[model samples]
Target: MDIQAVDRVGMILALFGPHRESVTSTEAADLIGLNRTTTYRYLNSLVNANVLTLREDRTYVPGPTLVQVGTYAVGRRDVLKVAAEPMQALARETEITAVLSLWGAASPVVAHVEEPPRLEVVVSVRVGMQLSPVAAQTGIFHGFMAGAPSVVRAAREMDDADRERLQSSAHATVRQGYAAQVSSRGIAVLAVPVWDTHGLAASLALLTTRDVLDVETDGPELAALSRTAETISRMLGSTRPAMTG
Candidate 1:
């Protein structure tokens, strides 16, 4: 079954992780204990397979295929199962809509949602909807969670003032552990991160009319949402300490 080849490929892929996002051919050669020529050849094969992209600077980064596979893997995590009951309870407690989102390749994508019963009006957030990173509070929160490089790259199309505001919002999200935005229609969305052992695994958001929901940092809604998110995060093996209410 070409076991040796498989092992070598696995080694190459293993070179990528949180601390090491890219690798040069020389680095790959040293990591795989192979010659530079052989390492370059292997990297080229991976590039052809769409698992890695050879950047202009000769570094190899995760390519489209890896991102697709990663997104699929994230979609199947137990976070969804762990969050289901808590989200339903949250919806009941807040009398609003509860949404679960995951980090997509380039943005935040809605994964699941729970709406309060008998609520004639609710935000129409559907699963698999890709949110606007520059516009949505949830997306800005995820952009912060994704790290600064991703934010800067995504903001390349933005004007200076918008970029400044976006950066400010992202930092605020990190410091406060949540993001909030109110729409012109008086709809308010408050989003908080649901962390896993590996960091932010998903975002949990509550949506309702501005009058029905308070977006204050220490408000009742944020407290309830934080509690529910804590429950889910603990279930997902997050090591973060419980927030003091």
Candidate 2:
């Protein structure tokens, strides 16, 4: 294999991150330190191979082949697989609904749910449900995670009071390594972050009635939840230390 060629391809791909979604041949050439003619040749080759798609304006975006390969890679090593056993054990231990939510393009979306065996009352959650920044404790991702698009969207939609409260909650979540909130219907929601090698990969959450579970900063449930989240994070290659309460 040509190591130099592979490294150059990796460099080109690394240019696409966070707010950057597209690149032109000229921009890629300048950023990657290549000559214009050489950059055009490389970009054209990538377009022919479907690794990138060239638009009318000459900007290149990730093509179908790139998207397919990315999706396949995530399917094999995503947080869902690493968190599954820990989430199931947490659900059973807490006797509450355990949820694994991934940070989506705009908000946290439910990726998985585990219900305790033989629970009389179960909180209903479905995969693909978009959790609200105001209504769901998982909004901590928007508040605490850097470069998330949902933060701007949430700030625009909230009033002064709600925004202040969310900011406060987000700060506390960072300090304590978890977020806790209660809904209008007296259901308690507690969430902790599950990190990967990069950063926060997902939120591990528990949902139960206020009577069934007390939401506390240093309570037993919070400790247990944090432990479970840490277990999953370690499995996903996170080296960050756990938050101590």
Candidate 3:
């Protein structure tokens, strides 16, 4: 593939994040560092492949096949089997409540969760429940399929700077298989990517209090979480994205 085509794909993927509406080609060309003609070609290719869709206004948004394939991929018995134990252990270790959420339009669906025995944390979703993708804890997920990157980047719901932050977070999340946040709620989570067979780290995460969020990886609890996350990744036939730092 030409380097120019590669650049266009990056831009298109970049544009899809955050923004909900189909984006104007002209607008996307400007954001992605590509000319209009090349931008449209990439867009059209993605559309044809069902990676993106063109609306009545000729704006491009994510298409159905992307979601369909992603859902179907995760639907495989093997995928769930791989994710189950790490999620349970994460909940037990933190005692702050834990859940495995799949990324979606603007929210996350609770694929699995282990609640505190006595304490109550207002979890936003049920086993299959979905909620916005912007929270501090939710950002620490394993998968990037199913509109995960898009919601983090260009959503109309978040301010431009905030969207960019999510975009950056997604980059690091996709790169390192982990993302962490200390939010206004004082909760902190360390998340890793749960990659698929393609080696695209999907989503893996750790939910804990801000107090223990920065625990060194050498520490027993943090080390255990790391091992558990890696075990899950191995079952998925993958590993965490390489660390750049």
Show how many residue pairs clash in every candidate, following the order shown.
0, 0, 25
lDDT, candidate 1, 2-73, per-residue tens: 998887887788667544689999999987699999889889999999999999998999999988997788
User: Taking the tens digit of each residue's C-alpha lDDT, what string does model 3 give over 34-106?
Assistant: 7889777778889998888888887888789866875686676465766766667666665545556555544
In model 1, residue pairs whose N, Cα or C atoms come closer than 3 Å (at least 3 residues apart or on different chains), thus clashing, are none
Q: Which candidate is the best by lDDT?
A: 2
Local lDDT at 139 for model 2:
60
- Cα deviation at 107, candidate 1, in Å, is 1.5
Give each model's whole-structure lDDT.
0.77, 0.78, 0.59
Pick out the ten consecutive residues of candidate 1 with the lowest summed lDDT: 135-144
Q: What is residue 120's positional error in candidate 3, in angstroms?
A: 8.1
Question: Comparing candidate 1 with candidate 2, which one achieves the higher lDDT?
Answer: 2
Candidate no. 2 TM-score? 0.66
| Order of quality (lDDT) | 2, 1, 3
Q: Rate residue 129 of model 1 by lDDT.
A: 72
Error of 3 at 227 (Å): 1.5
Task: Tell me the RMSD of model 3 versus the true structure.
Answer: 8.3
Worst lDDT run of 10 residues, candidate 3, spans 137-146
